[model samples]
Target: MTPADMPSVNARAGAAVEALRAASTELKIGVARGTSGETVIDAGGREVGSIAAGVKIAEICMGGLGDVRLIASTATPRWPWTVQVHSAHPVVACLASQYAGWRLAHGEGKGAFFALGSGPARALARKEALFEELGYRDSADTATLVLEAPRPPPAEVVERVARDCGIAPERLNIVFAATQSMAGGVQVVARVLEVALHKAHELKFPLERIVEGMGAAPLPPPHPDFVTAMGRTNDAIIYAGRVHLYVSGAAADARELAERLPSTGSRDYGRPFADVFRHYKGDFYAIDPMLFSPAQVVVTALESGESFHAGQVNLDLLDASFT
Candidate 1:
């Protein structure tokens, strides 16, 4: 817990990569090296990808600081499973490591390849402004990144990532899944806690005061279409994600945070996320940024032992998205 005990996110993620490699066959995931020598983990894009493999990728996405568990549940009626997540180091694990903030692009038009790079590799790249705000930078001989894409990254992108991280292309690792695959759905839904932490940071809440965090969201079936699958994964959290935080702050601040943290606080909260995306003319940046958050939140002030709850799960919208 001291400055001297600084943990390297990349180091932790590298360990997770080793574990994933050991169990790739059992998990039904593919493991290969990229043309650029970077390691590529095929989790959900191929015919062999499985939900269990996606769970491992989710862990790596948080730099091994978070726990992602699958639970059998009928609480949502439509979903038989739920993804539970928690992190003692929410700020570092979720915001610094898990958030998909790095935009990697190559080529153009039909042959174009674009993906938001998320995971410990981000700490090394320090490409996003959020890293500067966090005042954190990770260094390690090996780096790992998580991508939500339909295919393996191009050699150019892989080399770019390797160069940006100041590591050999052979030392870089990428875990990618198709957004329309079941493994992808599980991994995305597992980001419920990270989404909450990102929204909290966006609201200017004191990140250091957030001591503990946990969240859960129903795991919807993946759709065949990319956009629809994206919608289903997002709706899982926007409609029914439940997040709890133990924060060391004034009760008033906790209450205020709870009031402002839910997806309902956004003007774009009435319908499914896809509908809103279409309303914004398919421009993700054009949509309200505040709309990306849990549907329900309970912020408990650790100082006063009081909890402030805000927003309610919207089953009406959940039903609409799941079917």
Candidate 2:
């Protein structure tokens, strides 16, 4: 499909680049101009980023396709910096979450660099099942990506990304952050809503029926260690994250869907995610597929004006996991 015909997560996110640049110094983020003239924002890599930087990183994670804001949490005083996210275009936002997310691995062997590809560019790649299922594609002169790694992506990796997006190498924009950094934690926790949407999709829920999506999760403190950081981030979502989705569907269907939308639905519900990850020997796919959901989910059917709620936040588990 033509660029205009498809949802442009990159275009939406590109609009915010200037604002991020203008506040780079204040946000404690570093902006670098690549040789191809592509703009790269370093949210955590080579910089000690702050919470403001994390918010921007979270937005970038959604391919700038969703709205991310900070708010206070009523769940607990321990986590005050709760992130709130909403997307009118939930399908596009979720697509951005997958395509532009940290799911793709680039390179092999010693030189191989694993990066989470984000941006409107993933629409052009069309490599994953979600893209085909959505029947959506995007075309853009410039592509953007967010890499959850410490260093900038290699030149070859950038070239490969540009080629996949059908754009020149210079027309690429990349954002980098390490998972142990402040920006990394915020961006991952920001996926609370996305996780729910993905779970719904996995369960064969009607994507078109979802009209609005919103989610909230406490922002855990960032750890310099990667494993510790990953654990905390996952715990924030699986144990304490809460989400609400508005759909245009039958009330009964919405209620049934709600019953399956929380992390508790998984067999791996009680333990902290870090322990669970180790239990699976760090094989992400080996873990319970149902565990990758939010702590609570509520679906409101607009047609019937009936809301279905399921799941509950386990603060005690969250405390143990966070500690």
Candidate 3:
């Protein structure tokens, strides 16, 4: 398909930008203009990232392909926001995850920064394996990215991003959220379902067969320390997240896929992510690849209307990790 025929992540995310800026005060977020003239929305960096801001960030992450809702959680009252996501365009939404997901690392040294760069700009870069597999690309004059960081990117970083997206710096829009803050937590937890879809893709499932997807996870309280924050966000998915996918493939294939989709399929399944992180000595790539999946997954084959389920939520592990 042509670029014009495809959905634009920047265009969809841009709609939320105005609303986010308008409610900056109510959402406890700060908006600023970068030296490179890019628009920057601060979630947990210089300002406190509110639940509302997190919701907006999550929407941006999905390229607005899906709906994100903040619901009350009876399971974890302390972490009140239960993030729920639903998408009719499952493949497109998953493409959004690949294009703009927080999978990239940027900058260098103490002056360096790490960001899960999301939005349509990734298609322009086409640097990752997922992008190559999707056989998709996007073209737009303006680029949008959601960065998980504690501070606004440096001028050079902004310029680099614009360059990478093949756009002028002034045309870039970057949103920032730190992992150790409320906005960061909400945005990260929001990916519980997306992560599962990505895993299915990794396992070589026919992504186009997925017609609908929905997922939910408890929002963990934000932490000031990055490691602790990472742990909590991961535990939310590994121990408590649940996902359901409606697919148009064979029931047996869907069932087989479900059996291999959850975090329990990995060797690193039993511990809090922090401990696992330490065990791997902070090399994210060294961790069990399968451990990145959701705690539970259910797939319904549209052809036969049969539901196949796998994995289980380990509440004990969640409590241990959260505490």
Candidate 4:
């Protein structure tokens, strides 16, 4: 492992799960061992997950390489509740761990189970092409994965995960949170910085140049309807999420990055994400990949001590989506 990645993402995430398990009841999350012996965490599916639970879950999703927090900000009074996120290791924390790039599937047809796994376990699984680019791998006696499914995964799937992660099922933990749950909203909204890092990577900006990063986005109320809830959480970022990146690069490069990093650059920028999803017939791949970034940004060129700004908050779109 690289010096910056010394601790190993899985090891850090394992520490987080231990803490989550210790305070499961206070966090209002359901914790139980599956038949296969893997620990299952119900952040919202079986129990009403709280915002505090979401914050901790978000941190775990980053492989505990980052910090996630909640605060009330007059910065956007109309959407007062917000989630703030930061990481000293942006590339490792956001892409290697939190990007939800793992495609896990079991069975066939209607009975098939599928979820894009996130969190620290991905570092150990090395399932995505992303890990190749990262050139980093980790091993831990314990593993933790965060899933957005509405219910516990099949025991077969959990066993597969443990095997892939090279750990005993008893040493693995799976965290489940549905998009419509309150805790779910916080976890999704907390991806503001991860979204920025992802877009920056997509933009082909130098990941090594990203020295430090921070982001914030409004936390919308979770909707009972899955589509609306997903829309609100996504719109919270695409309409008002803000990010600041400290990069070690030339001013021109920084300015170019700032201009292209915001959601406004996408053809699908103006509408709520749910409408965009319907327009594309529910195929996420059909939407412009550029649409997944924060709405506002500041990219600083550390070499030149200059910062470039781009994008703006669309309160109208925010209100339309939230209400």
Give the runs in model 4 whose Cα sits over 4 Å from its true position.
1-5, 108-110
Query: Compared with the true structure, what per-residue lDDT tens digits does model 3 show for residues 1-323?
Result: 33235677666766777788899999998888889899988888879768888988788777678788999876555555688988776566556542345355566787776666765567666667776666666676877787778887778778888888899988888888888988888888888777888888889898777778998898887777799899999999988898999988789999998999999989998989999999999999899878988888899999998999999888888888777
lDDT of each: 0.89, 0.80, 0.80, 0.90
lDDT, candidate 2, at 307: 93
**Top model number, lDDT:** 4
Candidate 3 achieves a global lDDT of: 0.80
Tens-digit lDDT track for model 4 on 7-121? 7888888888889989988999998989999999999997998999999999999988898989888767898988999999888999888888888888899888888898989
Worst 10 contiguous positions by lDDT, candidate 1: 1-10
Superposed on all Cα atoms, model 4 deviates from the true structure by an RMSD in Å of: 1.3
lDDT of 1 by residue, 1-323 (tens): 52124599889989989999999888888888788888888887775688888888888999889999999766676676899999988888888899999999999999999998889899899889887777677878999999999888899999989999999999999999988977788889999999999999989998888889999999888889877889999999999999999999799999999999999999888898878888888899998889899999999999899999999899999989888
TM-score to true structure, per model: 0.97, 0.93, 0.93, 0.97
Worst 10 residues of 4 by lDDT: 1-10
TM-score of 1: 0.97
- Looking at candidate 1, what is the lDDT of residue 306? 98
List RMSD in Å for every model shown: 1.3, 2.3, 2.2, 1.3
